[model samples]
Target: MSKIQKIKGFSDLFSPESTVHTLMENLARQVFGTYGCQEVRVPILEKTELFARSIGEETDVVQKEMYTFADRKGRSLTMRPEATAGVLRAFIESGQCGAEGTTKLFACGPMFRYERPQKGRLRQFHQLDVEVLGTDAPQADAEVVLMLWTFLTKLGLKNLGLELNSLGCPECRPVFHQRLRDFLATIDHTQLCEDCKRRAQTNPLRVLDCKVPACKSLVENAPSIAESLCPGCDEHFAQVRDILDSAKLPYRLNDRLVRGLDYYQRTTFEVVSGEIGAQTAVAGGGRYDGLIKQLGGPDLPGIGFACGMERLALLYGQAQIPAPDFYLAVLDSRALNTALLLAQRMRERGFSGEVSFEARSIKAQMRQANKLGVKTCLILGQDEMEKGQIVVKDMATGVQKNIGQDDLEQALGFRKP
Candidate 1:
């Protein structure tokens, strides 16, 4: 039989690729923690209705991209394409998503989407998600956006820009939809892509988000949502902008920044980078005020965003892992037990390195140290053990010194005994 290969769109991440992903996750914890955001983990699969109701049924994500299947009992389940829906579903089920106190939570995990894999996008992808629940205050929107900005800035990524927009709430959005629909009537249907044609009939606002050149050109002079914001929405959006300005955070107000998700309302934003090729969006999210109640939870509001880990890895450049401080070489079978003890002692005191598991010749052991790029080597031989000492060699200069076993810590310069 032939050897088995990994799935087409799935990847086996190792070393530096997995390294950067870990660093990004840790930084998210550090930065989000500073802002009072706690971590939460939710299942990757859920009832299909969870997405259909949360993300609009007409949206492409629910209509085309979800990895949905049936269980033995015939109940439909879907691999999550995004994180916010599952995050909220957990809080709702646990009774924490309510009008009590503001809950700032973050989670990072794999998200599955059945779309064609692109440069930084995959059929199976991972996302670092952050969400703020239980408050509809405009300040919540600014806070979450600012928090996301802080996390990305900490990543040392360059050439990144934030795009901001306000998708008017239920109050004034209906009017804009009607205006957009009328504009579509004047254009020839053949000019729009099949997806946009369906979007125009089902969810007119999505037509504005179509990336097709033809559809984009047609919507160029179409109605702008800014022109239809109700007084409440306009003021809410203005407050969000003013707060971002006060924080000295620079952003561009892209009239077309409506995110792909349907739950977004009032404030929508995306962080794009020129470093990542065609798929430039490194992260994007917006406020979803009605999603909680709409999804059978308390009538709470939420704002959140997800940083695409794959795209972020592309932006983070290469990940570097520093070599160990030293290596322990056991040259004689009689010294094996002693070498293990020395290795354990050094590690307990915060020193790190590799130790030979079995007795090996000096030539072979030193070669292992050289391959690891370690600067110092500690040799434990039968003679050295009998003398109650460990030989330390400087790999670079080929200089050697003998130190008392008790003096190993001082020899390594870790700290005082």
Candidate 2:
């Protein structure tokens, strides 16, 4: 016999976990909608080139974390390791940018990233992503960050820290990069990781993101690139700061806070919490002003952020999602048909309920309902069925009452009893 087990880095979501996901999705959607962001669902898979071009090819996500494979026709494909690239691909592919004014879209979906699984990190996790396209104003950057901060605050995640930085537009970034490299030269290379050593020669900016204790200590006093921003980038960063002040959201400026993507330009920020270990970036995003044009779309600037739902859920405490309020259990063969019809009607009328499909005895059915945490159980037995009525039993109070079929909704407190 073979051992049955879930694959490493993956686990199942059953019952309350599934309920929690639904509630989170709905809550995020509601919040995004309130801010005039419409929901969009993108495919879970995309051409491998999409990410390679959008997220830097040198980044760990594309080089180490992406789940890529070849399909029957020998075309290389990959599950979307993140949502922003896929969202950008959709905007271009669907000609959404050409539609009209700005495009404000939100997406909630499963994102794939291969990494060592931990408490809040999973191989198959979810992200709530928000993107605004067709603007390059610093105000747009501020609004998006402000919106995210407000949203997270509303979710009761009060302990998060906002780290902000500006990567500067292409023309000014090279100057900062040279200065950064010069400063890094003073540090010993022996203390850095092999990857950081290699990155130093290639993508030197990423060397600052090193997590090793020795490397962290070495780079602690490194010069801030945000302080070196040229006139244009300087004004942009200032305006973003002004907006944050206006919104009364406190933030720490970190010059080394560059996003691990080449396409990202100008403003970049991350919302992190120390509650989780090293990968504490609960949400991160920034302005990718050149990304739209780079991806074969119109010359529109875009800004957005992606929040890891797993991390947020963990930090906020995973209160069990509520179960259905009522479970309608029918007894006797004659009542089964009516129970099925009633179950459908109850749901259609905005009631969370279920009816037994099997011919279980009344006691067994009631037991199942109690196990489900149902507060109210609808009983359909021989006497009630013959009298064209049902019994509404309050499981909590152990009170029962006979009500006609038409009064069922009213009995459940849909209206005055």
Candidate 3:
């Protein structure tokens, strides 16, 4: 028999790493709630057509990265590479669009993709997704961006930069597409990377997002999308900028920041950190006004963003294991029940405590308490039980004190409930 191992590109989060994940999710729940956003739980697996239609057939996610397969019934299914598409599907199927004019939702869960794994980039990763549906106003775009900025700052991420761009709308994108295609035609196709070459013919805008050094240089002098925007898109982009500026949110206007997704339109933004190499974007999203309607839903506009939890964890520095409020050590097997009851009382009083489950010597129990880094330990033994009292030891200072059983909660600095 062989020992089982975790699949490549998949990871097991343990100890302090799992603790950091919990802290991030808790903070997101609070911050997103403050902004009037409610939680939405979507499935991890969705129909293949959902992503194919929403994310576009030609995008890298659909062509290469997506974990797609055929089910037993010969129905094509895919594990979601992103959350927005499934969220919109749920909104439509649940009839939330008719009930609630606008929906503000936040979701946190694992998303799967089949890409080569690297630092901060995993095949199975998690995201904190936020979306505001049923609005076309640029203020919604600005508000979503602002909410992301506030969330990141609250997470103790510092020295972050916001990069903004506009990909124009259906009415104006054709003009820019033709101009970009003409420029690419002039350059020898052989000089470009294979992906960029394919993208130039299929979706010229994606070439701007290519990271290849050669493709990047070629795109540096490519026609700017800002210059080709029609009046509607231009005004929309300007208003988004004005709102961000009025709020004193500093951002750089990068005309080339065409996000990888095919759904983005009008306003696109990414929050970046220099601490992470190469993959600098910690969070990115934009206005996808037509996404809901495109996915067989009502004509509802939506804007949202998603931050890679792994990338955020990478920048979170060292993980700090949380200390327990108390550790209950039992010296004699006969006093186990008493120790458990006391520990439960402490927990109900809002103190986190752990009771010894195994019958161990006093010294061994003390060692376990120290290993857990608990601040205080309540020692329960036959002697203490007979006297109707307990021994309290402060792990930090090695101080010992005796307290009546009834006064245990007060001695631990907890008010009686």
Candidate 4:
């Protein structure tokens, strides 16, 4: 029989990759929590209608990428391809929609999509999502972006630039939509990707977001929605920019950042890194002022962004294995349980390390300790067990000493938990 293999475009995360993932999540909690944003978790699977309603039906994510199917009862279900829709559903169902103050939430987890995977893009990828709901104020937009920027900087990511754009609102988008439609109509059929071709009819703005180089070129001269913003929409976007400017958060205006979602309106932004090849976006989001109402909640506003963890790990390089404080090596089968108990006691005292699962030769155990980069090694042998003493070796200095069992904590320097 052959060993089973992982599915294509999906991957197993272990070692340094898992370490980096952990670091990102820890940093997310630390930084997002500092901004008064509470952490929340949502189901990975949801009713397919949520996505179809949140992300437009014609968008690439819904039409091609989502992992959707009918359940045993025949009700259509889908694994979430993105975080926002599910987060919003949780927010609405929790009845926080009628709350007076703005609600801020952050989530971290895997999302599923059926698209072709590549560097930094996978079928099952993780995201650090941050969202702010119940406020349409431009400060909310600026705050969310600033919060995202702060978190990325805290993670030690460099060479990143923030791009800002406004997709206008329902009032002005129709006119820009028509103008964009007109320009897309003039492009020859050969120049556009199939996805962009469909977008040209369903949402011409998405055609501008096409990843195909040829497709992007064909729509390069398409009318910019920024130039067509309604007075209110224009004002909201301007204030967001002004706030960003006031905070010394350097940003560039990209008239073409109509993110590939239909829920966005007014302000949109992305933090891009040159370090990551062609797919520059490590994070992106915008204001969805009408989504709450559309989802049967109070007519409120929300804005958020998701950081792609895979791309971030690429920028940060490999993660280091944190060294254990000690390694307990057992040289007698009778001492196995005692070594485990001692290691447990060490842990209870706030020291972290590992213990041998079975008795082994001193040399073999030392080799294992060295491989794990443990700084100290405690030897458990028949003689030491009988004498009620433990052999403690300083791995760094290559020195050894026998200490009475009662003095082990004092000699090993255990700390209070």
RMSD vs true structure, all candidates? 1.6, 2.4, 1.5, 1.3
What are the lDDT figures for the candidates, one per model? 0.91, 0.86, 0.91, 0.89
Better of 1 and 2 by TM-score: 1
Judged by TM-score relative to the true structure, which candidate is superior, 2 or 4?
4
Q: Which regions in candidate 2 have their CA more than 4 angstroms from the true location?
A: 1-4, 358-363, 403-406
Could you say which candidate leads in TM-score?
4
Per-model TM-score, in order, reads 0.96, 0.92, 0.96, 0.97
Compared with the true structure, the alpha-carbon lDDT of candidate 1 equals 0.91
Clashes of each: 0, 0, 0, 0
By TM-score, rank the candidates, best first.
4, 3, 1, 2
**Model 1 per-residue lDDT tens digits across residues 2-47:** 9999877888899879999999999999999999999999999999
lDDT at position 200, candidate 4: 77
Model 1 superposed RMSD (Cα): 1.6
Clashing pairs in 3: none
Off by over 4 Å in 4: 413-416
lDDT of 4 by residue, 54-129 (tens): 9989888999899999999999999999999999999999988778998999999999999878888999999999
